[model samples]
Target: MSHPVKLYVYDLSNGIAKQMSLQLTGRQIDGIWHTSIVVYGREIFYGQGLTETVPGRSHHGSPVQIVDLGTTDIDQDTFNEYLAEIKEHYTAEKYHLLDFNCNSFTNDCAGFLTGGSIPEYIKDLPTDFLSTPFGAALRPTIDAMFRRPTPGTTPAQVPTPTPVSTQPMPNPELVGSILQAVAAQAQRTGQPAASTPQATTSLTSPLHPCANSASFKSLLKTHRAVVACFSNVVTCPPCRVIAPIFEDLAHKKGLKSGGGAGAVFTKIDLATPSGQALGSEWGVRVMPTFMFFLDGHKIAEMKGADANELRTQIDLLLYQAYPPHKHTSLSLPAMQSLSLKPILFSQVPNLDAVANKLLSSITSVNNSERVKQIITGSVVPYLKSRSSTKALPTVLVAWTEVTSTLSSSLPPESLFPLVDMWRLALLDPAVATWCAANFSSSPLVTLSRVASKLSIQQCPRPYALTLLRLLSNAFSSNVLAPRFFIGNFRLEVIALVIPSLLHGDGSVRNSGASLAFNMAAFLQTGRAEAVRNSNGGGTVKSDMEDEEWEIEMVSAVVEAIDREKTSEDVVHRLVASIGCLLRLSPFYDTQVSSLLEVLQAKQILKAKLQPGQCGEKGVEKKEVRKLLEEVANKLCA
Candidate 1:
């Protein structure tokens, strides 16, 4: 389990006849070739793009020979995903060569895949030949005429970079050393990393009732991620109805059960002078208003005596967080002290124009056609394209102004466009991150704020699905890995994600499964590293220690992963997520024993496998069965 990488080497042609190319014009140069990193075999061969990477009766006449490179502390699945990205990159013409072709790709891959490369002879052949003056003069000519394109494509001019070495040399230990989390992240995401410095912000803790509006305002200004549960025993009869639910939820135990301890909940009595002042500032006309605040922004409000409505808003706010306080309550220095990479905004153009229109219109007419058009047409497009540039304070300001005034800015009849704009904005990580950090406290910036009106029972399915997808995109920092577990972010998002996973929409379930995959995969990779560094060290034993949350998470994902109904992508990702959880609670790890028993992880997976599920080829059920079998072996071992 500690070191888990395997390499696949292919001799592309039969006999040495394939390597035919002598000192000059067409001499005996027989050789065998073609290679791919076989890191996670049956465990992950089911994903797309395997036709070329998987060794079989390939375009090359002969079958491939497999080699064991052993494993590294890295998660083999993630490492495989990283390798997939590499194979995708190398399939390009710029990196290929006649002497160094597929073997060269394998060499680079082996280095990245494990701490070893193929025996040096395969890589050295090209370098040694190109070094001699006689061979050097003919090398370019030979490659130009003989080097072929990948079966279907036209061959491109291979750039004259340094050719691969043909002289045999020992593979250096340092070859694969540079490959760690950063390289894997770079390849997995397919984009350059952010240049911003590490940023840290204080996380809000669960709160008790506020004594007065002054205390409420003071606490509110200090941190983002707060919820004010308003009530009064004397005056408001309806406030009394939802008061106990609000009080219990404001406590640690209630927040713990809900998976939103990073959020603060306060009881504000509207009867008090300070409560009246606070209510006036937020325009509170009702008695029991559950106001959700993020980054000092009021995102959603449920003003009613209905406990269910109040709980619904609280759930949404909690679901949007990362590492709920129950998980963080133990105070592990490794997790709590980790420095967070700043979620900087990609500065957009025309900030003033967008802000001016929304502000002026909201103050006067409440909602204007001109404001919606500019936001939908201009504001969102700019964010999509330039979201990675740098943090734009002015743009953040505009977002704050627009979101804070959202309720008063638009009437119910014309609210759809603004919600549409919000969903689009959520897709951009920079905008999403920036919004979460700077504009979250303002009610207007949260996706749920715009999406609050769209009920699946009342609206079209796509509307609800779109909102869920927006939530998924907002948590898409799984690409970077850092943003997924830094503080309370994932905890908040998971609260929202679990319900969507249970949603009836296949597409909604797919997005939810993907989000689950990201969360579990992130946790698994960290735990994998922990396994390597210790004598099987981890303290996640007992149901209360980690079981309640981990079980709920895995159970939700397993329930959503229906081989018969789910899409191929959904099945694959969900299976991978389950695989992640299985790895965390491997049969050998006593620490994760509680999670193993309580979730019945193995039993559920076995029950889901049907007769034809693993037999079909095009449908991913076959691969799903294979992956499930592999997981079963690990869990039951």
Candidate 2:
């Protein structure tokens, strides 16, 4: 019965050793024997296919050479020769290497033979052997020298031998080869190939943020067409409500999709501050804007799309500009400006891509200088173009946010840009409406712009005049509670300008009057009293103090009412504003007394109409009678 003999040998040249074992297979041992006991002399041999020169048998092979440095009489001279032989073989047949010491070799051999024992020193070697030159070539040398028993060990316990590894161990060369194969496969598949590593992804690579315009531009080359939307009034609500729709449209499939051109949907408030920058760098202006990029170049421009309209326009632009290429398509083409695309609206689809393009282009400006240039040079003029209309109210909101952001936190010089933005907001009725609603909510914020907007009555009024119209509608619709105005003084400004309604330019004056009346009703709800009571004490006398302010407003409204006095065609808008105020004021009865007496003495009161006559005169009579009735009711109450 041949017992398993495990040998621990050392490679003197590389200063490491390993273990080998002979499993008891009832067959010739010659082939397996070579692997069991490695010869380390001027040559080190391990593995199969080697004839051993064992001693005395003419073959002279030491069936096993027990090289125990501690117990055996071999000194440094013998050790060095043994090491030299290992070197020769390793250099000639090097594969992968390992590191070890004597204690490590002993434990390894013991573990292999005993099945449960392993050497302490070799248990936790640093795995960085590949970092050294000898690491790759030293494995065989170490294995050959360490494959024999210690000098004093008894032969009874240690058999001559078989050498094989039953336990699993990592094979560095195999792993490395697998990695190279995988990388090659990845390359063939057109996927990003694995890097020089056999087994893991790299930690570093370029980051692509689809948020960037340049990135979007790159994507467009594949798609052939891209769409961008720009608007200034982006708040969380609009973004939540509206942005997703745009994204959905962008992602829609088989619309014979245009290759990816970078598309951006941004708010004007956040767009670049410079107009020239927006034009020269970002490529366009006039917001609530949209543009199409085809093959890396802007092919067309559009503006102000509600979701459906925007989709329609984009489809059209893409069809006209990018049409499906029967030929191979490349990335988007470089931008070309026939005369620089002009924005259609003041602000529509303001997105980050536009801002970035403009910002990057604002190099020559005097200061924090991006949006300022954009506002003054591009946006403002475009807005001023429709300053007399009532459609672009939201433009004001964007300008306000931009100016406010620039003025407060940006450099002192940033104020000039802000001033430019504020002026633009003031000039357009649409912009002013936006400012009045959003900015005027703050007294200090809206004072200057509100005052300026109100003072200006030029025709084709900033189409933003509709903002007031919208406010009027809100009043009539009562979405904004009548009682809401008590605490907000800014609404009073709207009231003060009320009588101006239907007076001066007739259309604006009438609109102004109606809005003022609505505001008065809002004031009449006594909301202000509650506010005053909360801030000051409650009392009807305190109400009188507020009356003083109301009186001044009343006087102004009266003047406007008189301006249109002779136009019997005029409406009774003044009556509504005044009547509501009278109901809310203690002095309403007292104040109208003199006017009532004068009308009575003039017999104007006697010019009565039959109960239901219907004409302009009848309407006038009815309003007069109603005003008298309200006065009588309040006075009597």
Highest TM-score scorer: 1
* Residue 333 in candidate 1, Cα distance off native in Å: 31
Instruction: Indicate the TM-score of model 1.
Output: 0.37
Q: How accurate is candidate 1 locally (lDDT)?
A: 0.47
Q: Which consecutive 10 residues in model 1 have the weakest lDDT in total? A: 196-205
Measured over all alpha carbons after superposition, the RMSD of each candidate to the real structure, in angstroms, is 33.2, 36.4
Q: For model 1, how does the per-residue alpha-carbon lDDT over 523-602 read when each residue is reduced to its tens digit?
A: 56445433332223331221112444566676677666543353656666666776665554432244344565565656
Q: Against the unseen true structure, what C-alpha lDDT does each candidate score?
A: 0.47, 0.35
User: Which lDDT value does model 1 have at 294?
Assistant: 68
Give the TM-score of each candidate: 0.37, 0.27
The C-alpha stretches of model 2 lying farther than 4 A from their native spots are 1-399, 403-499, 527-545, 562-570, 589-637
TM-score of 2: 0.27
lDDT of 2 by residue, 1-637 (tens): 2223334332221211121101111111121111122223222222211123332131222333443222223343644443343332222122112222222223322322232332222222312231111222222223332233344753222112221221111233432343233223211212242232211110011111122232233334434445655543433344344455664654441121011222223222223332222333455445456666656677767654466776776666545542332111222111110111111112322233334443543455445464555555555555446444433434444444554544345333223323333333443333332332343342124322433344435323432243344345433212122222333444444443543453356555665666666666555444333323222211132211255556555655545544453433233555455555544354544554454344341132122222223243444554455553443344212
Angstrom error at residue 591, model 2 = 4.7
